[model samples]
Target: MLYAILAYHVEDEILSWSPEQDAAVVAKVIEVQAPMRASGLLGPAARLDETRKARTLRGPGAGMVLDGPFSETKEQLLGFHLVDCATDDEAVAAARKLRAVNPSAVYEIRPVKLYVPADGFGTTRG
Candidate 1:
């Protein structure tokens, strides 16, 4: 099974960190991800840029372009990790490892249904 691990954090709090502090936290996260990467259980993962740089569009047709994501939440979606796991428990375990490294952030684990052009747009069987 494939899982999507969504990372959420308070943008303001994260922005308040010094460069060194941010680097240290990122290093810890990388350390936790090392085993999964080596074992080919990890896939694409990324940390999103600040929401200030975001844009949004809603409604019909081309939609009404908006300035930012404007998400109505205290914590913003920060990043995500894709992983291949045998079961939901395995996926939760992976998220737990990440939480151990950065306890402040929240991780949401969800099963993924992947579709690709080469796969004729059919959902890939996990």
Candidate 2:
């Protein structure tokens, strides 16, 4: 089986929708994600808080993790989805559905590469 990673560099801030509209969007997501999860097609999906809630680590010798998000670009990785799919077309279709709800935001779809050793030791290469 092949899987795709749905990643994105989001704007520094996201616009807020009205309570009623937010409820409706949540309802729609529930309908879609439920079916995909039932079929084992939705491997994983998540939403992250703003960059302000982030912490960064430099290196093994960098000591304690640093506070605050990047002070750099307006783009920050906001969230992602790992999907089990049959082909790139199917992945793109899924991405399109997500984009429909977040038209103003950007979305990216890429293949996920997993390495499983012949001995089946269950170690990840990347």
| TM per candidate | 0.86, 0.66
Best lDDT goes to which candidate? 1
Error of 1 at 72 (Å): 2.2
lDDT per residue as tens, model 2, 49-111: 677779988767756788867657556667776777888889888777766765654667778
State each model's CA lDDT, in order. 0.90, 0.66
Model 2 weakest 10-residue run by lDDT: 6-15
Root-mean-square deviation (CA) per prediction: 5.9, 6.6
lDDT tens digits, residues 1-126, model 1? 899999999999999999999999999999999999999999777899998988888999989988898889888889999999999999999999998999989998999987332433334662
Deviation in Å, model 1, residue 81 alpha carbon = 0.6
Candidate 1 versus the native: TM-score?
0.86
Cα deviation of 49, candidate 2, in Å: 1.4
lDDT of 1 at 29: 95
Model 2 clash tally? 0
